[model samples]
Target: MADTVFFVTKASGKQEAFDLGKLQHSLKRAGAPPSAMPEIEEAVQKMLYPGISTREIYRKAFSLLRKASPHMAARYKLKKAIMELGPSGFPFEKYVGKLLDFEGYDTQVGKIVQGHCVPHEIDVIALKDEQHFMIECKYHSEQNRKCDVKIPLYIHARFLDVEKMWQQRPGHDHKFHQGWIVTNTRFTDAAIQYGNCAGLRLISWNYPRKESLKKRIDRSGLHPLTCLTTLTKKEKQQLLDQGLVLCRELHRDLNQLRSVGVSEARLKKVEQEVRLLCEPESPIL
Candidate 1:
């Protein structure tokens, strides 16, 4: 419904990064009733993006329960089942623990001083040695070639909220240490720039340069967009699945135009035009 085109990681071909086992573990830790696990897990499998973050998955799980129709046994009891399945009732608290131990910022995800806005449903808030660090982890599509702008925006929202709150309240002026925005997909330029301006650490999907992303695209058995600049937003979102990685893939796909070796000079010119876009500083946003 909301732009059906989902950017995915090329490596695993998933729309979002999500771990069902971890979610199960989280639900248990949250003290959820034992009966709800099956129901929630079922909903997860049916509706959630496997590559989506733990928090988002939980949000969807709860949202499902809230809207569950009571008439149909399967649909009606589903939400109740999830609520009764685990020991820890709400998964949010458990996820907070996960965020605390995330990527070396253990126990430091809270306000630096006083007067900072209190966190709401966030993972963890550690206040130690006067430095405040807030870390939020986003589960994203595990695919290596898609694009997403939400993760960064989420992080930015947290940081800006803290900054604004601190500015308004003067007693402690914690100075909001840093915000961590980590995800499995590429970030838009606006997300990065806004994060930089706010001193937020924007960590996008990063893989060892074992091989160029371009190489992966060339090998994938899929049609490529030869004319990216001309593509509509929807077309571009589709192309973001593999088109942005490399033009070689495009050239290879377009070569099919010459199945019998017929040359379309116009296609060649378009390819050359698109080539200029591969530059590092291109305005991808």
Candidate 2:
């Protein structure tokens, strides 16, 4: 007798054979302990059924992971956490700036720069040494949505206009470097192709192979406050409202948690998770 295969529905509404290996890989990336994998895998397998949505599977695994390790569960939810950064793109733009700032770049979020033809509001501008990057952050609350070719096409034209003006500046002629599109989701193949051909650096959740946004966050220990399973939705929003985005920020100052009405008893649990999530790791790119 042959084994029956289960199909899983992706966020894009496409169906694919459920691959346990992918789940294992995700858990590993979340820094799940090897000892805990068997139980997670077994439990996940038991819950499998035809046409089950990937989001459902993730929640199940996340629940198990949260039980095993809150910090690891936080890491696993990084992508979703990023989406929670926005109903508006402004917070996401600022979050992108914070990531760049962590890498020793001088960054400005929501900066308006003069173009040769007009003024453009750059999402995030990262300056280091001679490299100047005009970054556009595409924030999507829905996982299925993607940054298509039009995004790069539009950003590239804006970049050219800005670069034209930048080159006429005394020191910026050679300083203005590349344009970037950073998103909390994936990019279409056509988008990636156009970006490469046009010399625009594109970054999505898991694109660019080894140098993706996920990899950057993992290495930098810059997990967002929304990743914490310990915090309620309201509490996370309150912290974000106060411009407290990074886990490291909360780890540094517990007063923010207190301000959000977190009790002294619960503060300890939140602090422990933040500390674990923000532990120093590999150097950022």
Identify the leading candidate in terms of lDDT: 2
Tens digits of per-residue lDDT for model 2, 184-284: 99999999999999999999998887989988787678888999999999999988888878888898899999999999999999999999888865353
Give candidate 1's total backbone clashes. 38
After TM-score superposition, the amount by which residue 29's alpha carbon in candidate 1 deviates from its true location, in angstroms, is 32
Model 1 per-residue lDDT at 255: 49
Root mean square deviation (Cα) for candidate 1:
21.6
Best by TM-score: 2
What do the candidate models score in CA lDDT, each in turn? 0.43, 0.90
TM-scores, each model vs. reference: 0.31, 0.95
Please report the TM-score between candidate 1 and the true structure. 0.31
lDDT of 1 by residue, 1-285 (tens): 233433323243435434566566545433344576678777776664425544455566655433331111112222222222122222322323333333234563323433256554444454445556565544332334333456566667766676566557665475546666544345566666767676766554332233222222212311123223333344333333332323334554654333423247555644553443332221111
